[model samples]
Every structure is written in C-alpha cells, then in structure tokens.
Target: MTDSASLPQDTQSATRPALPVRLKAGCKINLYLRITGVRENGYHELDTLFYPLSEPSDTLDIEEGAAGSGLTLVCERADLCTERNTLHKAWRVFAETTGFRPDLRLTLTKGVPDGAGLGGGSADAAAFLNFLNASAGKVALNDEELNEVAARIGADVPFFLKNVPARATGIGEILVPCEVDLSGFTLLLACPPEHVSTPWAFKAWDDRYANKMDIDATERLTLSAHMFTRPSSRALWLFNSFESVVFAAFPKLRAYKGSLIRHGAAAVVMSGSGASLFALYREMEKAMQASESLMREGVKTFIHHL
Candidate 1:
C-alpha cells in the first residue's frame, strides 16, 4: 500500500495543473435488513445486504490548487450548502489525513432526493475521498482506513466505500462481499414526497412492538445461496425487518409499496427504514415502463438497470 504521508511533497505540485477530478457516486438499496438490538452506545445492531445501483444521483468535482481553502458546492438543493454538505467534511478529512491541501472546488449535482433512505450523502463522501486519493497520488489509505473514516461519518458510509453488494453487520460497519449477481435485473426506485426519521422509526418500533416481537429470531433468518441465485426463489425471501414497524407508523409507505406492485413490479419492498421503496424487474424495459407509469401517477421515480 502506498502511504500518503511518505509521498514526496512535490506530488501535489505535479498534479496541480490538471483539470478538476470528477467521480460519479452510486446509490444503494438494502436487499434484506434486520435490526437485532440496540447497543450500549445507543447505536442499533443490524444485519443487512447492500446492493449498489448502476446510476447515481450526485457527482463530486475535486480541482487542485491550497491547504485550509474552503469548498464551493453547487447544487440546486439549498439544503446541500457548504455547512451541511458531506463533501465539506470529506475535504476536511482528506486534508487532515494526506497533509496536502490543494485548492479544490466541488460541485454536487443533486439527482437523489435527500433523506430518501438511498445513501446519497454516503456516496458523495466516499466518492470525494476516493477522488482525493487518486488525484493527489496518495493511495495511502487502504480499504480498512477508508472504511474507518466512512464509519465516522454515518452508519451507512462504509457501504459506499466498498461499492459492491455486501452483507453488513455490527452497526453496519462490518462488511462481507456477497456473490449475488444482478447483471440482468432492473431496479425501480420511488421516493415519495415524505421523509421518515430513522431515529423516530426505531423508537416507534421499540414503543409499539418491542415486547411483541423477537428480534433475535428475526436476525437468525438467513437466505439460501440458491435463493440469491434465482430471483424467483429470492423474491419470496427478500425482506426488510424495519418495514412492518415503519409501515404501520407511516401508512403512506405501505400504500407506496402497493402502488409499486400494482404497476407490474416483480417484488416491491421498502429500502432501509422508510420513504423510499424499490421494485425489482427482470427486464429493463419493464422497469422503465413502470417508472414512467409511476411518474404519471404523481410518484417520483428513478430507474436503473443493475
């Protein structure tokens, strides 16, 4: 592994003349997720499979130039400004780790809806970190270090660093690559015009059904390899442990899933905690048609072939 700290100081100067580095950060969907219990630190223990989507909403641009310099993130979403942007934190971390501060400006194109359970912010942060590693010729931080920084940002951050289908556990930091093939499938994502608070959803679960359900039994359920290889077999096994709790609290999400099923999706399920629902189609054309049909019905949709 190349250590960024050991690299000559002149490296940044050599790469300074090039144009800004741009990377497309991809979004992810949780194929199957379960919250087993809450840890002493107040974090939830979970087991989930994260599947990366081909098309992503946001783009990060890193242009070289000074250390301690600020960032300019251009996006139509006013909420994604410098102060609250994940790109800002990414830049700060990069500078702190690499010890090279080049004058850089970032532009985030907001195609993914915020708080939609799509891991958009995680993608942006991971993309920026990776871009910095390349442009600065550092290559110092290995996968483990990169993942450590990601976990510092959010529970879902580590998944974006791997950027592949993975089985995640332990507050979503531990990851194991899964050999699931989605090469010929299409995923249709629908982001309803509402946001569900993750913390609130968890609290609602604890309040209404903590005593009624066995979280341990739920965590013990596992998918067979054959089911993963065959979509038909897997469709019945695909589940999100958070859905029933969240759906009961927010009836609109359940209705959204119903709408997805009514529009010809092979399987419809909520991604992550709530607000965003996805339907899987075996064919791309069918997924595209479903997206258009959903849009006509006033539901915001994003379609991608994985």
Candidate 2:
C-alpha cells in the first residue's frame, strides 16, 4: 500500500428525529482505461468505462443532528473515517456550498476493500450525498450542483453518483451512458496480498508514456458503444492502461490473469493500478474452478455474477 502516511489527510454524525437512513455504495471495475493526456490543471485526462457490481458494497447509515453539531464518523477502520475520508470531504463541500445542516453522523460498514481499484471510498461518499439530496430537502442541491460537489471530492466520485455503466472522460468526472451488459457472466476477482498507491500508479503511467505515449500500439485502442453491448464484444475490448506497468511490478498478479485465461476466462484485466485482477467467464463452474486454482496459489478470490 505505498505508505498512506505521506498522503494528505484527505466523514458524518448522528442524532434526532429520524430513523437511520442506510445506503449501499456499489463497487466498480473499469472495463477499459485510457489516459488520453494530462490536463494543465494537473489531472490526467482519461477515457474509461466504469462497470458497477452489486456484491461488494459499503453500507452507510446516516443521521442528522442539531445544527452546528459538526460531523462524526464511526467505522471499524478509523483511519479511513477521518477528515481525509471521501465521505467527510464530500460533506464539507456539500455543506459549505449548499448551506447544509451541519450536524450529522454516519456509521460506515465497509464491505468493499480499499486499494483494490474498485472505487469503494468514492462510492461510499456518492451514496451518502445521494441520501442527503433526497432526504434533506432544505439542503437540496440539483444534479448539476451535486456533480460539482462530487468532482471536488475525487475524480471517481461523480461517476459513482450514477453508479451504472458509464463512459467517463475529463479526469473521470465527465460521464456519458455506456452499454455494458454483463448479464449472466461470472466474474472472478483475485487480490494479491498488496496495494498499489494511486500516486505511484500515476507517476508510473507518466514515466512509461512520457516520451512515447504510443509505446504500445494497443494503448491507443478506441472504445465504442457497441463494444460493451454484448459479452463477446466486451471481451474483445477489455483493456486497462495500468496493467502493463503494474503487472511488471507484481508478476503473481500477472500470472493469475494468465491462469484465469487458461482456465477459460473470456477477459482478464487489472481493474485499475491494481493489486487486484478480475476475470470474466461465461460459466460459473469455470469461474469456480479458477477460484480454487487461484486459492491454491495463495491469492484470495471472490466470484460474482455479472
């Protein structure tokens, strides 16, 4: 986990007059990721499609308190429940811009593991913001305003607001609906025992593409709506810009991908700058067998139906 100690201190409260509003924040995998260029604002311009999954989601129970009571967060992972927390950061932005009621608390139940490139933290924040918009009419912000709030928190925050299949650009905030129908497909996600920091991933990306952005002819692959509409097409288009560099660092993860493919996976790609790898299969039995094989290799695995 590239030592979070250096990352800038990057959540919620509870109280009266309402039942706790529980919300589920879905996790996602990038079907394709492309770094088109770097923007002058210091954010990498991206072209990626997000595919949300139902199984691995974090749950949040939010409750509002008296005004000026401030925000409080309760979680098993206190390190992730602080001001640097995306939920806390999103709350700060939303409350400041929208004049939201200050006192709030959130009990966060984390199901999605962090640093897996699943956008778990961003999704948790987005889910809470959705709850605030629907329940707190006094602090109601329109979709446009809400989008801005999400962008302020993280690049992936805005995308998780819609929480469906989307083609995202502009540092991953700009979104357009994309067709990614993975119905009946089985996904086997294997996490090697490690984490890759986002900063490290980006620096690696830049270093790899600095002088020769098209180092790999495959890096310039174009995405189309029709490519994600069916399983066959989706398999053909599966790409992640981080895979080459990341796999070089973690050969076990790379080997896992190859193993899954050999075990009949139609598509296997690193989800992000990942320590986690996901493989899609047409049959659950094949996925199950692959999981057993991976487990024998000491890589943790989970099978999910798409």
Model number with the top TM-score: 2
lDDT per residue for candidate 2 within 73-116, as digits (tens), equals 88988687678998888778887887765587778888877678
Candidate 1's residue-wise lDDT over 177-223, tens digit each?
A: 88987677778888887788878887886676445434355443332
**Candidate 1, which ten residues in sequence have the lowest lDDT sum?**
1-10
lDDT of each: 0.70, 0.74
Each model's TM-score?
0.81, 0.84
TM match of model 1 to true structure: 0.81
TM-score of 2: 0.84
